[model samples]
Target: MSQLYASLFYQNEVTEIFSDRALVSYMIEAEVALAKAQAQVGVIPESAAIAISNIASTALDQLDFDALAVATGLAGNIAIPFVKQLTAIVKQNDEDAARYVHWGATSQDILDTACILQCRAAMTHVEALIHQCYRTALAQAEQYRSQVMIGRTWLQQGLPITLGHKLARWASAFRRDLARIDAMKARVFTAQLGGAVGSLASLQAQGTAVVQAFAAQLQLSVPSCTWHGERDRIVEVASVLAIVTGSLGKMARDWSLMMQTEIAEVFEPAAKGRGGSSTMPHKRNPVAAASVLAAANRVPVLMSSLYQSMVQEHERSLGGWHAEWLALPEIFQLCAGALERTLEVLQGMQVNAENMQRNLECTQGLIMAEAVMMALAPHLGRLQAHHVVEAACKTAVEKGVHLKEVMTELDQVKAYFSAVQISEIFKPESYLGNIQDQIDAVLQEAKGEAK
Candidate 1:
């Protein structure tokens, strides 16, 4: 059942990148690259490096995944059995060259570097999706730069704000997420190449040289030391992903709330069989938002597990390292799924300008009380203005009349302000102070980043 519905939840592009075949291929690629690096450093024969690459490149299709799974169960790590199978394949071609296949390397070196390769690949897709989402949101903000809507606080009408201002905030979030992702590349993309004890003891005095060569071969940065005991890189990647997912969740929550039948201010783009209910004919649920929220809810928990795994015993971890095998990939998958869904929501979003206008009036000018208070603050003292507006709001609510009507009848308000000024105070557009400036700032910064 999980496999059947996997495509619905996870992206096919990212799924293929982290598939079993891709993982095994990465491990083999690590082995081949290591051999070449060792050869470059004169630690292994050049013929052996060539032979390892040649055999392992073709051996992927021939390797039995079921057999590898069983061997992994017994060996405690996939690299142990994987290396044995790779060596056997190389030995079949050139027996003498097979001896140097994985010389001076440990299973952790292969596994960790392979995982880094997978992360590097997955992040490319993630970054692209983030860019798409960012651009879509920025476009929306520009398109609706002056479209006024009621800003809600604690689920009640608070004040007037433009839809563009709200979307600019989302664009800014994705922009910051992109910055975070770019900043972490140096820390997270470093190569892992330490022998059994992370000292490269097996490689002797030439360990550092071999590590440098290995990293160069894989186009990865060499870490200051082996990360067998240190899990900061892994934790950093997971933490950043969790933060991005959380931002996506906030967008989804807002969108779903706006789609409520009573509110009906905005909606997910409509399509046949997209968000339809099986029994109810009128249902148009926010399915993409729900999926993004599920990912947002689950990613932090998985990120916490990675944090827990940071505690290791001695030179290596007993169960801590093992815990990462499932958690990290699941994190990547869930994050990818969330990013894709968020992009979908942004691209196909439906905005109801008329509904937004109608909803703004539902409060009968109560949402503009602050505007009235501020306008009257100069004539009446600040405290007196607040009290007068407060009383008028109460009168308006009790009598079911517009606050503008109630305020016009107030003796204090009529004493300070003309009828023209009183009418201007109630206009939602007039009360939207500096919202265009704020939106323009966000758009300008985002465009600068693009340049």
Candidate 2:
């Protein structure tokens, strides 16, 4: 079922990078680790370990997973049928050794190991996609670093800013999220082995050794205790996924807004047949951005359920773990889809620098009020300067005159600055302070850390 959903919604390049086949291989690897742990604890004979290792090393096709699934009810699941099949394979020549395949471990030990492996694989794709998106954003920022546009606050034009500066902010957010995911690797890949009741009493003397050996075999960190009941790790993964998707969603929303016909400062690529609304033949809608926003919005709701599921009872809460099983993969798949589409949208974006500049002058220099006010602050008291600027702006709006014309009408405004100074204040380049430098810093940091 997980594989089907992933194939349907996540059959993109990123999904291919972290395929379910790899996840199944990881599950098989965990089963082999369990067999080895049993052997070290004297629960299984040395011969059984050798045989299990040999069998696990072979292709998954070597085992009839379909038959095993029916036999042990492990279809569309990982751990149970894995153990059952390994036990069956081990007992083929020595029936007595079948009892040792699972030994003191519960299903979660194997399941959690498999999940970590899957996460590790998925993280590889996540990291790559994040870097790609950040690089694209940096490039876009550099291209429009000085491209002036109106900055809106509360849906109103509040100031003048470069489009590059805005894009740099989005890139910086992605860079931070990538760092966070890298930092979480150690915690997320830790082993899970709390046994049936969050205790290793069943293994007694060799519990620690078995856990260490199991972690070594699977190439994961050995946790201090079984985390069957403590689900913070899963919650953390979900939260990170949510945050990354949300950032991309914000970018998508920005694109959607900018591509509005009345504000066509930016647009997605004009695909031959894409984004066509049946009723509007002339529409080149921002469908990629819209899809990304929808994916991002839906992911948070799934992640919210994951957060709520953390309050589980006892050492092994089927309710909580089950909730995670349902929510985690969906989050992974949804996030993958969003990232894929976001990358596509950004890489092929149609940046209208000409329109951006034209729109910068759309309000006839009213966007420069702050600049005008700041220039007048030294000559007038700050409050008095603000009042003078505000009154001029109001008069300009009512009279259909430019703010500069209204400024020319006032003796106080003339005494504060000349026409050249006013023109410099309205220049878009002056307002984009350190925006490119910030992008360079973020890109450098991301590259250094990724390496």
Candidate 3:
């Protein structure tokens, strides 16, 4: 029933997501603010609040959204026609009271409320997906915590690390992003109060109370002043969302690379009808992961425009606000979809522990050079030990012999450690110092936050 994809990508389904129903909620809050402002100043009868309340309670389906859309263009936003319709409906019942509907407010008041309301709704979806992805990442980390694999520094094998360690890093990054979202709630949920320009000069003495009451009615926090020209909050929120999605994208890209046939370290599980290439019958692709990566890459670029839109002229600039109106919703929806798909991909992931171990040994004990060097440090000086290990590693590569074997053949290496000790240096498990502890710390923090 929800046309999320259609509305976001195709720009169809006008009354869905950021639609009339959503804007009507904003209008209701704006009308309440107006009535409260008027009542506080004794400008309008308190009875008007009750009348406005009743009129505003009408459903979105009762409004003439079609004519409003056709008349104003989607760019007109639903707030203008919304106030027009609300005033018309109220005036038909009581002509005298209709004048009090929008008392001291301008279209920005209603539009800003509607934008935040849509953001709240969209964020709810995004938060759920983020949590889902966090859970999947935690599970994957726990599942493969001890599965040893070759670690690459610059696309070449550098050391040995457990698959779980790699996954736990991903989990940790997402967890940090989740904490950021929680911390941003106060900043992001604040109500906008710019009237015509960036000041509340029209409301005179009752301005602050009206703003607070309006925010209370809408379940949002009131800002100290109007934000007509202060778009930093919007930019901040957009940047965080982009950062969160970007983390997911990084994970997807890594997974895509690891899923390469030459690597085969991990694979996203295939569904019954998923990942089929058009021409290749035997092809199983990382399509979902790739999709997540692509979406993540696009979110930041879209959000950057929001940041750029912050440099508007004093009071108001259609250039800045209108740019936001075009960009923010799409960024939120795309990021939400990317996060959702990332969670789905991770939840059904296939981790190959055997392949991880196999790859860890693929370098013929060269992956254990650091461990060997560290072991020899107590006997040999640090530089001397490193040179010896480096030479052994080079000989192993050039002569096609194992590093441990080369080390055993050397009298210097044998003097430092026995053959058995040399063999122990190459065991991947010995090199996993603090990795499990790090994972535990991350998981503990996540669990504590969840509680």
- For residues 198-223, could you state the per-residue lDDT of candidate 2 as single tens digits? 67888887888888888887788889
> In the order shown, what is each candidate's alpha-carbon RMSD?
1.0, 3.0, 3.0
User: Worst 10-residue stretch by lDDT in candidate 3?
Assistant: 6-15
lDDT string for model 3 (281-338, tens) is 8878987776677778678788878988988888887678888877887677667767
Positional deviation of 301 in candidate 3, in angstroms? 1.4
Candidate number that wins on lDDT, 1 or 3: 1
In terms of TM-score, which candidate is stronger, 1 or 3? Answer: 1
lDDT of 1 by residue, 252-344 (tens): 999999999999988988887898998998998999889889888888888888999999998889999999988888888888888888888
List candidate 2 stretches off by more than 4 Å: 1-24, 40-43, 62-78, 93-97, 433-437, 443-451
Query: How many clashes in candidate 3?
Result: 0
State the weakest 10-residue window (summed lDDT) of model 1: 1-10
Q: What's the C-alpha lDDT at position 104 in model 2?
A: 83
Question: CA shift at 350, candidate 3, in angstroms?
Answer: 0.9
Compared with the true structure, the alpha-carbon lDDT of candidate 3 equals: 0.78
In terms of lDDT, model 2 sits at 0.77
